[model samples]
Target: MKDTVLNILVDLTGSDEVKKDLDVNLFETGLLDSMGTVQLLLELESECGVDAPVSEFERSEWDTPNKIIAKVEAMTNEL
Candidate 1:
């Protein structure tokens, strides 16, 4: 799950550094913007079976790679 989320983030951010730093603030670094977040949610749903709605997305909760992975894991577990 961690690897899958990281790959999505890396592809979204276009940075290999996302894989290197789990705690990196994707928003602050300008790696991920609002547009990227929407795309991330789509990828998460399609690739990992995580069906989190856009309305549930919160930047504070999903800023880092680890957090995003955790979110995906939590959402998937709910199913």
Candidate 2:
């Protein structure tokens, strides 16, 4: 799951370093933006089958890879 999430982040951000730093602030560091987050959510749904709705995405909840993985795992379990 971590590898998948890391891969997704790398692909979306075009940054290899993101895979190494799971806790980095993607937005604050300029690695991601609002539009990127939306694209990421869509990618998560399509690639991982984690359908996180845009309405429920809090920046704090989905900021880093660890948090995103937790969210996706929780959502996947609920499915």
- In terms of lDDT, which candidate is strongest? 1
Alpha carbon lDDT of residue 30, candidate 1?
94
Against the true structure, whose TM-score is highest? 1
**Candidate 1 global lDDT:** 0.90
Summarize candidate 1's per-residue lDDT along 1-79 as a digit string, tens digits: 8888888888999889999999999999999999999999899989998887888998999898988888888888889
C-alpha lDDT of residue 76 in model 2: 84
Clashes in candidate 2: how many? Answer: 0
Predicted candidate 2 versus true structure: per-residue lDDT over 1-79, tens digit per residue = 7778789899889998787888988888888899889989988888898878879899988788878888888888899
